[model samples]
Target: MYIRDVTKVDIETVARISVEGWRHAYRGIIDDAVLDGRSVGEAARQWQEWLEDLVRRGDRLAVADDAGQVVGFASYGANRDQDNGFDAELYAIYVDPDRLGRGIGTALVRDMGRWLEAHGYEDVVVWCLKANPWCRFYGRSGARPVAQRIIEIGSRKLEEIGYGWHTMATLREE
Candidate 1:
């Protein structure tokens, strides 16, 4: 698989991956009703607007492509929490559920880390739903549990755990 910045051509594919990833990964963790109405076309339009905004803010979105198709993606930018003390945050990272364990997610993250480092960001944070098993992936990626919060999503109060990395430089080691 090859990793690079997200492009206009990858919008729909990435959005579809986002929807599918959430559906598959959050099946038992998140409220089913929240994921029920998601569709690729609608997600694509939403992601298009988000991507444009990210671009305007100098954020980075990277995609993992296998055989010219988007298999995974990661987006990162300045930390959202005012007191997090982190320079950057991994806003999102998801690989097609079918492609899990093939290193696509890892590669996308490494790319995002490198991009963050190049932009002079040393520390980064990633938050995942506490009920989601995918949080283990962050542990394996060298992030440590640092914080937690409850976020309301469509009437559901979900607990989120924050993982932090001291530096992006180490993401290049492995």
Candidate 2:
């Protein structure tokens, strides 16, 4: 497996993986309609916007690939939440459902954290659905739940748990 920077050529693959990841990760936690009702076009548009934003801000976007196939992806930058109270934020981390447990997600996150630290960020934060298994992955990466908030996405409302790694040094300790 190889980790590399994301490019426009990888946008569609990222979108597909993101949709699959959401479907698997949000199962039982969110309404089936919301998950199944999501359109690839919508996801692609979101991916395009995200890529544009990353390019504009000069943030890091990394993908884990196996033989040129993207298995996982992550994005990190300065905290976007006005009240996140952290210097850096992991905007999204998603692995293809079929690629779970392969350590791709872990590597993607570690790379993002290191990128943030190298850019002078002292703290990093990530938010996941409170019931999502990915929360445990974040915990294993030395992130502690620091806050919680109710987020409304489409017609579904989710309780999101915010996890924070106060410093890159602490992440290495995990």
Strongest candidate by TM-score: 1
TM-score of each: 0.96, 0.93
Can you write out model 2's per-residue Cα lDDT over 31-81, one digit (the tens) per residue?
Answer: 888889877778989999988988899887889989989888998888888
lDDT of 1 at 40: 90
- Model 1: lDDT of residue 5: 90
- The residue-by-residue lDDT of candidate 1 on 100-152, one tens digit each, is 99888778878887888889889999999999988999988889999999998
Clashing pairs in 2: none
Off by over 4 Å in 2: none
